[model samples]
Target: MKRTFRLSFYVICLLIGAFVVSWLIFMPNGQERGAWRAETGGVVLELTPLKATMFSETAHSCHTVIAFPAHMKLVEMLEGATVGMNGAQLELAIDGTLNTQRFDRLDALPENCTAPDPASASARDVFDAAWTAMDEHYAFFDLHGVDWAARRALAPAPDARMDDAQLEDMLLAMTAGLDDGHVHFGSDTRGYRSPAERPGWIPEGSNLNRDMLRQIAIANAGATITKSQTAPIFYGLREDGIGYIMLREMDVDVPIGGRSMDAMATAFANVLADLDAAKALIIDIRYNPGGSDTVSFGLAGHFIEAPLPVFTKTTRIGTTQTAPFTAILEPQGDAPDPRPVILMTSKLTGSAAEILTLAMREIPQVTTLGEPTSGGLSDVMGFTLPNGWGLGLSNQTYLTMNGDLFEKIGVPPDVPVPFETAPFLDGKDPVLNAAIAEASKYLQ
Candidate 1:
């Protein structure tokens, strides 16, 4: 699985076998002097192309396909390279999937290429390389209230006598004060990560599968079964005149992933159309880990009745941040009139799922219940240590429209209720139970 650099602890990636027209650039664009450009339509992204063997036949083949097992439509079939010095410029919409790709050879700096021989560098050299990279690219020091300079000063340096293990410890110490989950340190084998919040992992031994949900909807809700658009997304009406749309995550079918936002909006429109007869609606995201922000926005747009500013974000460059980019939400495609809506959540809900919660909270008829979402925001941007080790950090910060920050602190539920997997083990759902009871108030 392959995903964008802007990932939470869990974000997946994959795109269609694009690059068929593989716009190859052997010479410089004469723009960046040493760099070249490969343009495509979609999200603006710079992809690193590792060294590829050139036999004079040109770039061809999906030699290695990386898949990100997340809940998103974002995917790319990356092939060919130039020692990671080459990069591609992808033009993806603010809410579009990346189905196609391009390739370009760029003569860039060493950090963009593979690391130097690990044996050639001292333990201290590797540590310093990591420290310097963060000094230049890491983004959330201010938000975490961390004095990175002071912290760096106090950090224990790797001594010549220290082994690789000790060096790893020293690197981990550099960001211990920062509660950003995006922070990461890794060698060829071992690794360490600082979680933004706790209790965010999925519950153990939980069997919340499509089969289970289908059984519950049929046996208890007395809903009609339609063997269409199965799994991932489920929609139907309950015996008590209530409707539900339980999405496993903000994902899409591969075919649909290559399309535009209108495609996703139309999918939701169809689901809502099926639930049109119900008196109230229940939207469950209790098990969703996360995916693309665009997919989340696409789903949320269906319920949004008016243009509303939900969240603002900015990239951290050096000590300052980039200009703020605020995301607006409004109705798209066919949407039902405002009705009593329940959003069931849990610690598992994070990344774009958190974005969805943030967006839904603004509506008057929507009430979020169950556990708070995972506080893991920001994309995990990656860097290469001098010894070829991997270093990841949060280089962006997302905030509410009112400028409220929830980093390391999740979005709280309007009605807090602990969800238990044991209930699912017994062929029941605690989250659904709570939603059903809450739906009582709106029942006419």
Candidate 2:
């Protein structure tokens, strides 16, 4: 009986030992249980909110978005950080299935580094500042084939005897080499003009007004005039069963009578309803300076039967990094009946107007007529010099779906109608005339 009891005790001890061995093997170690490591290092360029974007020398990459662990309070540590600083590093420790991260080390920034103050900076300082601004933010140096370093060498250094006017001229000459129509440098006293030429038809002094243009279009088409002075829409059906709508500009509210988008859309719908029986439509955007892109989308929505991707824009976020986003036109209201649509364009037709043309071109039945566009589609970023001079530069690029760059190269017309001032002087619009003839072909 004693031997049997001892054997039972030994058996129970063996079972307990087996359970301990299994627990040791299966249970995670305290140090190894919930730990992961991810690390990237780069020169800090921009720090906003909980995001840090940097230019890393190893990969030659910029605008890398690094998310900080909430527990680390890294953003607070970056409060003193400044742009153009080098030797910035980040380390993150992620814990467990929750994947919560903690900062291993977020070093405080040194106080010695800061951007130069533009307020009291010298001429050379101002020039250098402007150059650096473009170097860091301008989106198209390589695309424009501009040797920015070479241009910097050509800039005259600030001398104690130099006047503001001379400094302005030097800065102007430096920017002129870029050949970008969007680049501008100016002070209250004077400004620099870009030599880039815009292609379009410009009527003589008195005939340049919209009233005269409307009259010419009306007389040429033999169409009764239905106009809203407030909405600034000129629309009617031609006697030959062709429809015409002339939009001078796209604005949410016009100064003439406080015209709103709803009013504009209503006006558009009314005109289309009147011309519903017409065989074709002619959209005249000649000399229309572009306004809100939202307005352009709203206008394009009426014509598109489905959601159409028009173009995409890429903005420079670092010296060599860019972020791209797309703009699409969603169908709004009922889609108009598919018909042959001719869009009239000129050098004066630019910005949102050009965007409208791009959206319209996506429609299978639409054709762009007249001269090439003004080629100013991208949004401009403005900068101010330390010397109180203001500068504007194109900091973004726009492209079509097939990846065509149209910054300086305007959108070409399918049917080219070379604009001549003589035709307008003689009470004739050859461009409009050409569109009418083109529409007639589709009707027959």
What CA RMSD would you report for each candidate?
11.4, 17.4
List model 1 lDDT by residue over 359-430, tens digit each: 888778899998878777676556555555777776667888778887667788899998665665677666
Give candidate 1's total backbone clashes: 21
lDDT tens readout by residue for model 2, 1-444: 999999999999999998666555433233222212123122232333333433211121122223332212322233212122113323222210001112222333223223334455677766765776676666667766888878878556466435778777778767755656667777667887454333334533555555566567666765776875445567878878899888878754423322233445565666678788889999888767776566666566777777788887776655443445676777766665577889998776777788888778877889999977877776655555655566667766788877887776678889999877777777888888899999999887
User: Which runs of model 1 end up more than 4 angstroms from their true locations?
Assistant: 1-122, 137-139, 142-147, 150-171, 187-190, 195-231, 256-263, 335-337, 418-428
The candidate maximizing TM-score is 1
Off by over 4 Å in 2: 1-121, 160-167, 187-190, 197-221, 254-267, 319-323
Global CA lDDT computed for model 1: 0.60
- Which prediction has the highest lDDT against the true structure? 2
RMSD of model 1, in Å? 11.4
